[model samples]
Target chain A: MIDLMQFTFMQRALVAASLTGAVCALIGVFVVFRGMSFIGAGISHASFGGVALGFVLNINPLYTAIGFCVLVAWLIGWVTEIGRLREDAAVGIFFASTMAMGVLLVSLIKGYQIDLFGYIFGNVLAISRNDLIAMAVLALLVFLVIFFFYKEFLLLTFDAEMAAVTGLPVKWLNFLMLTLMAFTIVLSIKAVGIVLVSALLVIPAASAVQLTAHFKKAIIYAVFIGVVSCWSGLFLSAFLNIASGATIVLTATAVFFICTFLSPQRRKMRRRIGTLVKTQNS
Target chain B: MTTPVIDLQNVSVAYQDKIVLQDITLSVSPGAFLGILGPNGSGKTTLLRTMLGLTDPFDGTVRVFGKEPKKLKRLREKIGYVPQQSHIDLTFPIQVKDVVLLGRAYKMGLGKRPHNQDREAVEEALELVHMTDFADEQFGRLSGGQRQRVLIARALALQPDLLMLDEPTAALDVGAAESFYEWLHNTHKNLGLTLVLVTHDVGVVSRYVTAIACLNKRLVAHGLPENVLTEEGLQAMYGCDAVFFHHGKVPHLVVSTRDPEKT
Candidate 1:
């Protein structure tokens, strides 16, 4: 594990995993809070469509994936605004159709022998310099957006109607959050793939909730857990010559289990505290 | 005489083909406490949203301070709203102070961060509602009444000139609900702000509100509580007749009614 860091590819893999994990988990806090887990799923699958479209156009798959994902994100936002259908239902329909379209596009590509499994399951060690640079830019954007609109996002996620009433441009902020989620998904797609990307986004936060009741603490715990899993998975995958994405997810899963087991339920803890207070006074 | 802060001129809203609020005209003066009374699906919430410009009217105009509600971006700075539900995840990790700080997002905008002013406003707001002690508590850890108070503090942090509450005590116990209404009126009086509350507890809130607006897909009536709470007005707003009785044990009026249209 120590010797693995000696290689450049291993180093790149570590960097990619950390950045991707951190960004996804941060955005995931909103996603989970907003109950937009399905939206994340939809965007990830839609990125697959972008990949196929890129293959068809003979361009870099990342560009097409990001483009298609963003376009789809905008469409979902626009359609939901039409007020004709529930947002989740609209996103679900868009996702199903886009996924099928991308699959068909991929199947039609001439001599499609690559199998394209990497885009689905991910190949973190295979990240190019360009991909690393893209991840960096995306990480910066994610940080900026989260930092800039932290208050508005908090209000919107918790109570959009109240946010709107408070004059925060709730509609626009919601659209922006959706767009950013798409952007984050596209950026992390090459690292964890669509199937597992949401794991990076949701699991760490869920686990963090077990240990802390404060929003900021939960976020801090999620980032800490995510970075740990990324580094550990990167090294473990390198030494074992296994799939980096899968290994990272495994590490996260293990973390979640440990946290869940050790973390006490809040209600029970409160009850115990009440008893202790009574005993101390008596 | 003071100018009206909210003016609704023939405003109407429809969801799909079904109209929720028809052309309704009403005006509320600053510092007036207006209680909106209606049954479920009576467009009480829609009326409030229209006033806030969160929902667009199909016809006519709604104005806040003589300007269109849409143009009231700055007007929102002067308005505070406590929704029927705060919509925050109980499981999400957020402290009461953090939730309260969200009220200043309008004044804070994109690049700037919240400062001492915002924090002080949050503290003041919490203090007004008697929830200052819970300022450091996690939002999810609060009881229903405690959570409601926190939400009210979030709105109050705006230092609004107009305060709108949608069923503020909907999920609270009877005792808690009464106390919440008391605090609401007390705050309104102390701040000298316009207060609009949506409630089914018409008799209880009638004393607190300066006027009452009864809505059932339209503005059935709006006037002093004595005029708006008449039998006809109550029947029109609720689609049923109400029985009024006073128990010596309880100082407040108790109203019991059945389904309106059936009778």
Candidate 2:
């Protein structure tokens, strides 16, 4: 463990893990509160399609992933807003179709894709300096937008109609929200891998909500949980020589279960049940 | 005479083939506690939304504070609106104070945090709703009646000239519902604010509101409570021979013979 710092890849991996964990959790707070978990799932899967397209075009997969994911995210937003179909049902259609596109696009490449597996099951230790820089830049962009429009996002999630009534540009803001989610996915996708990206986006926030009544605190706790589990998972995966993405997600999932047990809401329900039992006995 | 707070002229709203509201011409004067009385799906909510410019009217103009609602965006700042079903996202992680602080978002503008005045406004609004003690509690942890009060406080924190409430007590029990009306009555009297409440309780409308507008896709009657609460007005709005006679403890609409239940 002492010699771990000597390895530059370990240093880069730790930094990438921290960046991916915190940013994904930040956006995850809104995604979870909005109950748009499926949207995140759909966007992340669409990112896989982007990567496959990038491989076929012989270009940076990151750029194509951004293009593909943002378009799909906006399309899902439009479908939900138009009231033509239920939100999950619309996202479900995109979720399955995009993955199929990704599968088809990957097959179009004549030879085995060398870098494909890196994205599917992420290799954080393999992160280069440029990848770290890209992750940092994207994380900063997500932070700036959320900082400026924090109030608007809060109101939109709490009650969109009320936000619209208060003269806020609800439609444009909604687009901006989808765009942010896309950027966040692109930011962390390379390091966390495609499959574990949505889990990172959802789990920490889910755990945070169980413990706190305050939204701000939930964000804080989510980031805290995210960073800790990310660092530990990276360390444990290295020591045991296991899959890093799966280890991190399992660690976070375990934390979520623990949070549920300690949740104040659960305690209240327990008290109610205890009284019910007493009444029945009497 | 003072100018009216809200004025509409021959407004019609449609969703594809269905007409939600039609040919509605109504004006509400200042200091008027008006009740929009109608059954479910009778355009009571649509009429309210039209006045707020949430839904566009296919014909005629909807003016609030003497200007078109869509044109005068600032009109929203002067209007406090508590929308229907205030208990949205009960499990959303938010404190009651933060929920109330959202009402002050317009004044705070973009990228700015709440200053002293903003905090004071939140405190004042919570105090007005009598939920000051629960300011730090989770909004989801509160009872249904308490949640409604907190939502009302959120609207009141805006410090608007006109107030609108849609089915404020729809989810509340009888005891809580009565208290909600009493609180609204006091708020109207003390603030002297123009209030438009959408409700279907004919008896409560007669007892509390100064004026009434009965709607059944179209405006059936619009006048003083005494004039609009008659049997003819009731029948026109509800599409049945509903008599306002005393059968139970409280006087309510009793449907007699020849009743046609419309879906």
Candidate 3:
């Protein structure tokens, strides 16, 4: 175990994975609560187009991915607000088109297929010092925004109409949330790749929600689950020679299933069903 | 005259080319319990939205607290709004106390948590709604009636001068609806708060509201409930004759039906 930390790549991987996990899970809580899980999935896939474009244009994929993700986030927000289409429908439209572009761009690439594959499937061991810096900066920004606007976000997620009537800038805050989500997804692409990034965004938050009835508690639990799964999954992957992203997602899913069985809400539901059965028999 | 809490003059609202409200004029005085009655798609919600500054009128001026509706940020502090209960996701993992405490968001501003005064306000609101015992419980675990009361309590925590509700009793049973109205009446009387309710139930307006505004894309009638709730007024608003009767002190309306044989 100590020998693993001796490797600089392993040390970088650990730091990057933990930061990505924490930030993605924090944003994930809002996603799950507001029923924007599809948006998360959409934005993450949209980043693939950016990555492929970067490869073709010989630019840093992360930067291009950030730009692409932000554009898609704004598009989703705008379409949903215009009331011409449902949010899920907007998400679906972006999801398919962006991925289609990404596949087309990837096919056009002459070489560096291996490098592109790293972003598509994620290679935690390949995380550079600059990538760690980007993740740190983004994670800091994300945390600060959430800290300052915690109450506002809570109210918006709970009752957006009430928030708007109370003079909160509901539309701007919505765009801000989506933008933050896009940045978080872009940052996590190094740890989980484009395809698996949404799992990190949703699974920890979903698991946390099952365990708690309060928003604050749910957030704490989500961050905890995210960090734990990241660290454990990284170590497990390194030891077992498996994929880090898949391991982390599987770990988070396992926690979610366990929480589903042990949650108070689940017990109450079971009791409700038991009484219904008994009443019918009587 | 004392400044009206809400005053809308010749306000017309449109979504794209479709006009939802046309040349509607109304005023809500302080301490007035005004119920707005309208048929489906008759702009009752658009009226509420215009008053709250959530929607811009295509024409005419809207005032809340004697100022332009959009420029009433300070005035908004004195206003509490409870949206339709159906809009809320009940299973969204929020505690009752937290839900009520959201009323303090504007007061707290950015980066500020709920202080002692905010907590006290929440507690008082919970007590007013008779939900003090369930303050720590999950909001989703409560019954439909209880959830409605909790939503009201959330608004009450704002210590608002005017409380507005949009179809609050839609999801409630008869007993719960009565109790909710009773609670509103007491709160209005005791707190001296103006209450604006948008509803389709004629009984609610006829029984509890001090003033009634019948609207169908426009203001059909605006007066005391007994005067505004006549068969002719209801017919004009609902596009059909409706029978009005009183069960005890509460007035009810039943849509009229004509049989071919009778005709």
Candidate 4:
């Protein structure tokens, strides 16, 4: 592992892994809390279209993906707010259409289908210094926005109607949150790929929720689980020459299962049931 | 003499092409304990949303705090609102204290953290609702009535001049509902805050509220509970003959269904 760190590519991959893990999990807390896991899944998959568009236009795919993801996020918000369609329905529509577009664009490319696969499955070892910088900037931006609007976001997540009644600009705040979620998904694609990014966005948060009953503590636990899973998964993948993205996601899932098994609420319920049985027998 | 705190003049609200409320007019004076009674799908929730500025009336005008609903930014801070308890997600991981603290988010301003005053306000609200002991407990772990009380504490943390509740006692048991109304009545009497409650329970409206408005797609009657909770008033609101009775001085409206064969 020390020898692996000596390589510049491995160092860059480590930085990318940690950054994506922390940022994705932070945003994931809100997504999980608000029951918007489908939105995360939709946005990550939608980025494939942006990636294809970038390749077709002969520009950086990350830039194109960013623009495309933001556009899709805004569109989802608009459709839901219009009240003609439900949020999940809008998400489902965009998710399928964008993926379809991506498939069409990819077929148009004559050669190097392997490049597209790299984006789809992720190649952590291929992370460049520029990618690391972009990830860092995005991570910083996401953290700053969350920090500034922490209270408002908490209120919106807990009770959106109450937030609106309290004059919190609920609609705009929702759009901003979705936009930030898009950025997080886009920045994380290189680490976990589009197919597995939603896992990074949801699993750690779900695991953290089982361990804590407070939102702030849940976020802290989620970030911890996210960073640890990514670090350990990256190490194991490098040692075994396995798929890093899948390994990271599996590691997070493992954490979620462990948390579920040890959840205090579950234990309390079991204890109450045990007491009831004992009382009935007596 | 004084202008009404909430004034809706010939207001009509619609979702898309379907009209939910049609040409309804109401004016609530300061310190009035107004109860809005209507059956399910009778636009009770829509009326509260209109006053909160969450919905725009398709016709006529709405004024909250003597100004247009859209221009109530500063005035909004002075209005505390508690939506129905069913709207809250009980499974979400949140503590009672944090939930109450959310009430001060707008007042804390953008980018500023909660200060000592905000904490004090949260504590005071919890005490007011008699939930100070449960402040650190998980909000999801509480029973329905307890959760309702916590939600009320959250709204109270806003320290508003008007407190609006929509079907606050809908999920509570009979005993719990009775106590909830008693608590609300005491709170109104002590705080001297204007109160507007939307509920389907005629008993609650007759027992606790000073003024009553009955709505069924439109305003059926509006005045004192004694005047508006009569058999004639209820027939106009419910579209059916209702028998009015008093149980221990509490008024109750029982809808009478006539058999077609007998008619």
The chain A TM-scores for the candidates, taken one by one, are 0.91, 0.93, 0.93, 0.96
**Kept native contacts, fraction for each prediction:** 0.77, 0.71, 0.82, 0.80
Residue ranges of candidate 1 with Cα displaced over 4 Å? A264-282, B246-263
In model 1, what lDDT does residue B123 have?
89
The DockQ of each candidate is 0.68, 0.70, 0.79, 0.81
DockQ of 3: 0.79
For candidate 4, the TM-score is: 0.96
Error of 1 at A40 (Å): 0.9
lDDT of 4 by residue, B121-239 (tens): 99999999999999999998898888889888888998989999989998899888988999999999999999999999998668888899899999999999877877777878877
TM-score per candidate: 0.92, 0.94, 0.93, 0.96
At residue A189, what lDDT does model 3 achieve? Answer: 93
| Highest-scoring model, TM-score | 4
lDDT of 2 by residue, A84-188 (tens): 788898889888899899999999999877688888878888888877887888889998999889999999998888888888888999999999999988877
lDDT of each: 0.83, 0.87, 0.89, 0.89
| Error at B74, model 3, angstroms | 1.6
lDDT of 1 at A114: 61
i-RMS, each model, one decimal: 1.6, 1.3, 1.0, 0.9
lDDT of 4: 0.89
List of chain B TM-scores, one per candidate: 0.92, 0.93, 0.95, 0.95
Native contacts recovered by model 1: 0.77
Error of 3 at B158 (Å): 1.4
Error of 2 at B170 (Å): 1.3
lDDT by residue (B1-263, candidate 3, tens digit) is 79899888999999889999999989999999999999999999889988989889889999889898778876788998888877788779899999999987887776688899999999999999999999998998898888888888989898999999999998898887888898889889999999999999887557889999999998999999878877788889988655667765445855566455765
